[model samples]
Target: MTGSRGPAAASAWIPLVVTVTLVQAVLALMSRALPLFGMPLTASSGMPPEAVGQLSSATSLGSMLFFLWGPALLVRLPSIRQLQLGCAVSAAAMLFCAAGRWEGLLIAAFGIGLGYGPSTPAGSDLLMRVTPKHLRATVFSIKQAGVPLGGLAAGLLLPAVAAFFGGVDAALVTAAVLALVAAAALGFWKGTVDDARPAASAASPFRHLLLAPVRLIGLLVHAPRLRLITAAGFCLGVAQGVLMGFFPVFLSDHAGWSLTAAGAAFAVLQGLGVGGRVVMGWMSDRLGDPVRALSGICLASGLTMALLASIGPGSSPLWVIVLSSLAGLTVVSWNGVFLTGLAEAAPEGRVGEITAGGTFVLFSGYVVCPLLMQAVIAATGGYAIGLILAGLAPAIAGLALMIGAGRRQR
Candidate 1:
């Protein structure tokens, strides 16, 4: 009912998809680069390394705040406008976060987070509105690849740029400019795919905004499938957050690898993720049930986490690279399929709402994982505890998804 159907639908969605993907990539580059971006501050200003956490957590907090109200914004505004607003905010926030010090850093990080808040719900709304159902999984997966690609650029490209132009300032400025360009491109889209609004509902706009939060909470509480899937999101988030946040350090400190080797391993992991998203998403598309495919990926992800836990200093570097890269493919990949399945699970016209709710839980993992990892490490007196926990979480998530998918089959 929302997207154009047949031949027009396929062609129409491409430009929006490219726009949304670029926006996601730039935002991701900005956020993913934060810890890396802050290192110079730690070195020069003697800012505590802990300060990076504040910035990172602030971004998560900002995202949560957006999830609280972002769905409601889509209820009235077109997804493109919401997306453009997000881009503007992200561009400014990237610049602010890069330049600001101390309190400024925290505030800017929060702003960056806030800027990210609308992207998933708005992008999901836009994609689902315009994308034909048959192509949704593959196309969305391809779009989702932007996540890893942005990260790749951050890990690979930004460092190269920083070496000459120097530091995060130049890189952050580049991200900001791209964010503005993404916004400008969207402004020129001129499509009506989801631009039309229904006649004024019985409820006033103010009322819709006021109660949207309540509705979202209630939906999470009552929607059994969604609740299960979101819980899985939490599990996946914990594993992902820990994997990304700590893998490099683990390799350098614990595994006795050189910094360059650790970085290359991280790059391999991310590169695999970029390809895996599309491949898994395509498989999901063909399956006619993305959740089933997602379950298998989660299951594989758990297995890979278990493999990582077994990797120790005694292991060969070649063995480490192979296992670690596989871990990347399984753990870091699969978001596209997962999110596509989440949107598909929702009732029509409600993808935005579902995505917002789901993304909040996903981000909650980001907020909680650091503390959780520390606790697990302290309790067990080892990092192995963290890896085991990550392994178990995704395995449980896989089982939950398997059950959910089975029930749907019935």
Candidate 2:
């Protein structure tokens, strides 16, 4: 089922909320850990800082591959089982990463990302069954807020742990322990949460794999709402990719901010993003239309990015903080609203599969847009042109959605 309108007892969906939220947090911690600990991690691993980014790229590639093929696995494994497996894989990846060898880090990064692949589709599958339609955006946003919280933990806790415990290995081990404990804890909730099983398929896994891309394309082609939202998601991903992936670097290298100052600005952006998700969720619920909420978000995000791209050495620090806060409020906060709309648009019995397909497109933006941005930067010898293009993508998408909504109303 997509969603229902009646009020639901908290008991019916609260457990699902907790389960999915915890899973999101774990995934965020694992992925964000690499960037936060990059200096020490690269130094200890005997890899250059630039080379460490390749590991992150590897992780994204792994996630995209799994998302493409996830529906096949969903036919056999319940969402709860998927979550458990994701956590377990992440735990193992962390341990492997602790080896501090280049080859090991490459494998571990990809493994952790593969583990993260199921997070949205699986979580949405579980939540949509129990969560009321009225409360859908709020609930999903609450779960997604765990991402910013996990990132906050990475920024605040990991550095301290590394400092007190003597190095990067201790921090890696600490993250691994958390993943294992989360996996074990999930086992208790399995029977209760895995109430809905995916319909079984007669096709072999190989056959299913072969058909995955075709199936996803067919879904998008048939579902107009899903296609629109998926495209918007890709555009939004470009802005988000630029901000989260390169914001600090931009502030330090282009804007002439100190490393500590740049890091503080980043924290402001991420910290405010937690509250932003919740607020955006409430707005979406009140508006009774996730699309409108997302349109506004994209517009705001584009505005913020444009403003940020204009900042340079002589710009005021207060202005930088303001822009960062706005970026956090819009760019990072759009995910929950976007995901809720995607879940609502999903056809019956195919929420997980459709979500996997949509996310695959969205993840493609994260992987591809930055490369384009780099090319723009190389050609222009300045950051402004690239950032402007990033902002323009979402602006155009938001305007298109708004116009489309208007025509439909007419």
Candidate 3:
């Protein structure tokens, strides 16, 4: 095990990390594209702006379905090949979006999400094999940073491309081209990375697909460590989803900030989130306990989110900016550490299965919590109650994790 951390190992893991990061970044960009371009897209499609929500729902539906069956695909295809197929599907979907109408947008959004689904489990499968145990958390953090990186690129570059070509279609086309190019580039590494794929299952592929989610849930149910981390993932993911999904809206509605200012603050939060992931990962490595790092993050997230909920129109921009940055560090930065813990606890030869299952659990928070937040806002006619409850979730989870660890030690 010690010898596996040598220069030869470095040679392998470094490229794998870079490759996985690239895939993650591309997936993130594709997931965000339609929403970012919604104004122009809806205008041209003769649909109301609210239709974007329908498109988003379609995409989320596609992604959840893929998460359920992702492991079955891994059983038949190597992780790299799965990634390539996903990219190809995304590229074609983007093309459809660029060329077609409202119906096309709905179909394309779902396709893009389906294509994005392979990223976590497949990337984890590749990286877990080569990453050194000592550096696992930090490396995973670095790769996870690609998500924010992709968001940044979409923010800066997509608008420019849309403006330069005089339409959103150009932006869509450019993204499609990038996905296709990424797929082609990965081909060069397939021979190197695909050698360790599990033997193709002899069972019926459709049967295996239908049972994948059930099997994954069973794996999670029996593993106490996985169960704990999955709960943490869900709680933290709620905080994250609430922050990202509603931060700008909350600032505009309650904090009395202009939409532009709110967006700028949101960007600051996202930018800081990138740094937070790396820092937390490094801390996990130093502490030799990713769970401790996650606990601390959740605690901090709870505090900052509570403070954020209290800000009103009269609040200073400095307070809003500072709190948003803190939210980035706490709310948006937990994924890598959560994933590190997940990979570490996964059964041997079952990392992909466990990752897919855990991801499904975590992602459910993203779906359910936002709706809950909306409900709170509707009932109370204010954002504060919803935001505070969101903050409280991770705080409790963090305390629970701390107590659980202490009990295990005793």
Candidate 4:
């Protein structure tokens, strides 16, 4: 993508990593910007919370759609262009969000999600190709750290920008400028960091779209191991979705913590996740078997979820923070390791396709789990009931991964 036709030089990793990490951070910021940016956008535009939900749904659906077809587009476009395109889409989304009414925000959110869709998989495709095998997990984890760092940035920067600009316009513009700068930088670089495959041959786009579903179904039906692993990833997604959606509320509502305190706790959880991803990733590499190591981590994090569920309002505040930290470390840290594990297990040369498929299933959790958690909470009228169920997700995932690893060993 950057270079002519050659693979990226090893020394190019520094800028490449920085650029991709920034991409991740930007997308992460967008994903988390709802309360920060979303609130202001809604207020200024006179949109209701229900409208915001529709906007969020649009984003997630856009992401899922891209995850399904992103790699195909990747093949058709230069990786550099792909990276820049993702940023551009997000830029457009942010601009629309800052100015557009509810309808505009809904469309903008979809653009944002679709734009972010190709980033990780494309980045992963590059990392797996460029980095040495031993370093993949650590390096990927470093890239993955962008998510938490992005969250941290949104927390620290967006508010000040909004306050400074006296509106969300200046903040969104700043975000857009950052993405454009990154995209421009990659364009100027002479290295070929992303030119992995030849452009898609002259073929009808519809033919490509028509065949995607058939090929996807075939990929799973023909590969039982991949299917099981994908299913397990879906479970991880459920655990991730539930906790991400519910943790702050649970802290405030059930644990009787103030909103500020709960938000602070959530920030700490995100901070911990930044370190947790690296630690878990390094451990997976050191153990030399990501699947088994991830299994253990999943089990450990699941226990922390259970611990959180057991902590009622009368429980010590410090203990809740402690358990939250544990969950943050174990549950939130799994993505890099999980991505590495999925890559390791993919059929040779099929990593990109598998990554797309796995991501689709993973995102399904984001769509399904929170709704399920909400229903469970509503039915039981207790946070613990839903949380206990959330706790089971990772445990189930660990079991599935452990069994899969054992079968591979045999």
lDDT of 2 by residue, 257-291 (tens): 75456656777787788899989999999999889
| Model 2, CA-based lDDT | 0.78
lDDT of 1 by residue, 137-226 (tens): 887887788877777777776666666786667767777787788788877764546556534446788898788778877777687767
Candidate 1 stretches greater than 4 Å from native: 5-7, 38-54, 98-102, 192-194, 197-207, 252-263, 310-317, 374-382, 403-410
Choose the strongest candidate by TM-score: 2
Q: Is candidate 1 or candidate 4 better by lDDT?
A: 1
TM-score of each: 0.87, 0.89, 0.87, 0.84
Model 4 lDDT tens row, 199-250: 5636687787767756665785577656766676677666776676566556
Q: After superposition, how far is residue 182 of candidate 1 from its true place, in Å?
A: 2.1
Question: What lDDT, from 0 to 1, does candidate 3 have?
Answer: 0.78
**How close to the true structure is residue 408 of candidate 2, measured as C-alpha lDDT?**
98
TM-score of 3: 0.87
Q: Model 1, poorest ten-residue lDDT window?
A: 42-51
- Candidate 4 segments exceeding 4 Å error: 1-8, 35-57, 99-105, 160-177, 188-191, 195-197, 201-203, 249-262, 310-317, 404-410
Off by over 4 Å in 3: 1-9, 37-57, 95-106, 248-263, 310-317, 378-382
Q: Candidate 2, which ten residues in sequence have the lowest lDDT sum? A: 1-10
lDDT of 3 by residue, 1-410 (tens): 41224565557778778878887878777866776665556778997443444565566667777788866866768888988988998888887785658998888988987898888888888888778789889988988877766655665667678768866778888888888888987887776646555877677888877778888889888988899888998888878767655665567656776544655676677678778888989999999888888888888888888888878888888988788778767787878898999999998878787888888888777666766776677788888988889989899999998998899899
Candidate 4: C-alpha lDDT? 0.70
